[model samples]
Target: MLHIEDLSYETGGRTLVDAVTLHAAPGETVGLVGPNGSGKTTLLRCVYGTLKPSAGQVRVDGTVLDGAKERARRIATVPQDGQSAFELTVREVVAMGRSPHKKFWEPDSAADRLLVDEALARVGVTDLAERPFPGLSGGERQRALVARALVQQPRLLVLDEPTNHLDIRYQLEILTLVRELGTTNLLALHDLNLAAYFCDRIHVLRTGAVVASGTPAEVLTPDLLAEVYGVRAEVAVHPATGAPTVTYLPGPRTPHATTAPASRPSAEQKTSAM
Candidate 1:
């Protein structure tokens, strides 16, 4: 389980994550969603231990995260943007996740290599294992990064924009795999439909604070969508899966712009104007 208690991160007197509290039950897939610059990435960074929270505490399975190595053992994170200048091969990158389990300067054992290979195959990147990380396409890189995280086999997985470069097919495939991993997952996703499809629960963030959190059907109402995202959207149920489906229209309101109508005018309005 992952638990965040009143977590906040501030710098230069500006708060990026504001007193956010949430939890993911064991083996649950929880999603974090917000518009661009809503502090979703910043909040994930705090959980990943790269950026320490200015206030509040983060605990995974009752263990308080204090340092890099300890946190690495408990949480495996696929960052929004990975450092691509390492000049490492895909297999090498995935192998690096095992570092936390090994002593300094120790070489990987046979079992470690087997786990890496399994992770590569699991994410459908086994063919790219020998290829250089920088040479692969964006979607390929994302899968490779996921493979790395899986090999770590942490109690919790933290991913930011995991489907950023994936095609529709891979997006569904990877998310399905994540759900079946039997581990706690906290991901930041831009695709509302994917979040609704995969996450057991979702926490919506706006302006560095959590505006709502609940099951997809419970929290993804049209009113909340309009208020938090400033977009005209509808929440409906999927026919096959019976899950929430979100449809976003073009019209939206901005703080500086007037609110768009909930629904567009009918043909009669245009004919009368003409």
Candidate 2:
């Protein structure tokens, strides 16, 4: 449903994204996994039309994405940054998602309001509908933005760290909700464990390049983790769901062999010496 071909972006003589190519099939959730400053967000920005690519093209359903309105109608993005500029009711904020489906200054129809309410409810933010946006907590703001993205009803959904500031429960909830929507989803996630659990396929990015791409069981290995992230780790499957889990190993490594004590002192001898 979405295609990014040799997408590269650079500024000030430094490449933020370099020749990255990826796609999200219809009804599939593909994850972009990388550490901070690895060009995940910049690549996503190029895909979402926030920034133009220096040497490639972004296509939706076979046609190149060229403008804002058509792109909005086809792709919905929940950015990593969620700071609101103006004070607006939560409902109003979500209602803005409907603008693409309407003409200029055309009032929202009953269907739009219904979709907004349903989206808010789905994201578990219905009670905050009447509240002011700026007053919301960080997690609440993320949920609010997710609600807006849902209401947008685009064919492709792109999220840059959708779980930012969310608690563990909401982190799972937001990704699960996106999965249930069954749309073509491309999201940048920092948590490899979460990526393993939720994404059908994962793409690992290092610096500005794609280092690996495959299913969790295929891509996530101790060696790859060490190579890409410089972390000593072990990968195991969850007992319940069979998803991969990462266990990081910190501190210095244990010696392969250790010397044994020459002789053990008896408790009575130690007591007498003391």
User: Which lDDT tens digits does candidate 1 get at residues 138-181?
Assistant: 89999999999999989999999999889998998888788778
Candidate 1 residue 247 Cα shift, in angstroms, is 1.4
Candidate 2: tens digits of C-alpha lDDT, residues 146-258: 99999999999999999999999999889988987978999999998888878878999988999999887778877787778877777776554556777778954332221
Residue pairs in clash, model 2: none
The residue-level lDDT of candidate 2 at 97 comes to: 93
Question: Distance (Å) between predicted and true CA of 74, model 2?
Answer: 0.3
Residue 177 shift from truth in candidate 1, angstroms: 0.7
Give each model a TM-score.
0.90, 0.91
Question: Global lDDT of each model?
Answer: 0.86, 0.85
- Show pairs that collide, candidate 1: none
* All models, RMSD in angstroms: 8.7, 12.2
Instruction: Please give the lDDT score at residue 141 for candidate 2.
Output: 89
